[model samples]
Target: MATTNKTGAIGPVPFMNDGSAALGVPLAGLTGDDPKLWVRFYQGTWVLATFVPAIASIQQSFRPRGGDVVIASIPKSGTTWLKALAFATMARGVYPPDTAAEHPLLRLNPHQCVTNLERLYSAGQESMIEALPSPRLLSTHMHHSILPSSISKNPDCKIVYICREPKDMVVSLWHFCRRGKPDVSFSDLFEAVCQGTSVSGPFWDHVHGYWNASKANPEAVLFLRYEDMLRDPAGNVRKLARFVGQPFSPAEEEAGVVAQIVRLCSLDNLKNLEVNKPSSASQPFANDWFFRKGEAGDWVNHMTPDMARRLDAIVEEKLSGSGLSFA
Candidate 1:
């Protein structure tokens, strides 16, 4: 069973003597962030964390609407793709497939199109998020258990979470961390990742949070796998549409609406866009950071046989008997 912190927040609190300390408290002798973060374990998951004003503000306030839709994921687990698909899925008639010229996906990075809950608090935009209209579109890396009570209890809210194969996810996250400059060595990072020492990880638990939620409340939370989505995106897109309560009409399907969304959100097209090309003001990371190889087995080039085996074992063990398998 998991425990609560001093703040009465439920989660995996690391090294808590009696589980009474507040979450996100900075500590010594840790090279936590990628040179800038003060990492913390809040209720058991990692956060690109800050304790003072940011956490204080979010913890005390920040309401979520019941009609909201959340694109939830562990970082680098196809967050951008999911956001684009969700926005495009909802904006179908508004932006229309052929009128991609005026589409927001054409103008803004996925991060911008869908506000990130954590980043909103970090950047002091909690009020803005709260003010978003009904049926808000947002994203979060928070585990399902730790999400605000307003969101978690809102029977009307919907969460769409996507997870990737363990090996591919780790590989992508490593490359993502090292993208802008030298941060952590891949070898060092690999061990830390396998040990579940990254933000919002023990990735398997993160996967299971929404996976179990989806099983328990299929209408409220939808769990999707990156591999499955990649293998059959149209079917997945259809699933997304239905989950979001915006299924395509027969007329829309006849107009190749499904095909357009898949093509429009394709990595190849997204990467080639000027907005996602190496530099852009709208992007927090390099536009290029989000566009690594989207293939599932890219880990082969990076992981040694032993390392690969280690991750495979962990994935198997963590997901064992849980009705979840990434491969």
Candidate 2:
């Protein structure tokens, strides 16, 4: 029963009726009249019910090359901070001494600095990937189940996976998930978090996959914990530098390069920057406050005791005997 407006194709949109629809393209079984499929026209085409799971699968199948340095994390798990740190560490030798502004670390959002594997592998991006120089940098949220098989087999490429405490993750996720729609209830969002139905989730599986990989090949995979980084960023930064084969110079250390990078990428600095604010060339969020309250344990303020217990139970069940627990 739904009709599309005359416009170009838009990406997938999921709705409450267990049906989904997209704009600008004709898709089978997306009509509102179908009892099983929910249909709506967003932007122009009918988004189909089947697109959600398909996109998830498609995104998961993305791969990186041997020369690539991949930053992998579940969403809202200090991904931005890790990306900045990694990017900065790699680019340390590229910039002139005492010239801070020229560093990509100072000027760009980590998302912009690193390419997503899914976007690069899409039909339009083949040429772009090919043109990139060796030792290309990349990022992805794909779980271990869907990671490109080559990543495990290839010894040349380096993978860094960052993890955050589940409580903070859920809180950050709630804020992020509600940005597009104002009325999203925390209880409903908590349900999605527990089920791993949120974007780029099934959280435990994602973390455990890399955890096992790091255990198996410590040199190939680097595991970072957000709490550890928060506690001793300088020390962790040094560790990351060594892992990437780019140890900081004694002069750089004395000049406090680690602290400089942290300050440059701090929530306050990033939030106020022109690139992150709306209307800039590199804005990462449609709305402001993307870097709000980058502290740990904020979930204690928002989650009720019952909700906390439910989330803990899910985590306990998934992490049992894995020898991995979040901070």
TM-score of each: 0.86, 0.77
Which pairs clash inside model 1?
Answer: 11-43, 12-43, 12-44
Best by TM-score: 1
Please report the candidate that would top lDDT against the real structure.
Answer: 1
Model 1 agreement with the true structure over 1-327: per-residue lDDT tens digits: 533322232311111011011235322323343334446766777665553345446556856655578788998899989888887877664566567467777766677677776666666556665444445687888878787767766788788999888888888988887764465567776776777777776787888888988999898888898888889999999999888777888977898989999999988888888878875444346567888889988999998999998998998998899888756
Question: What 10-residue stretch in candidate 1 is worst by lDDT?
Answer: 11-20
- Candidate 1 regions exceeding 4 Å error are 1-35, 51-59, 280-283
Give per-residue CA lDDT, model 2, range 134-208, as digits (tens).
Answer: 456677666665665667656877888999989889889678756644556777667755766554556777788
Which ten contiguous residues of candidate 2 have the minimum total lDDT?
9-18
Clashes of each: 3, 10
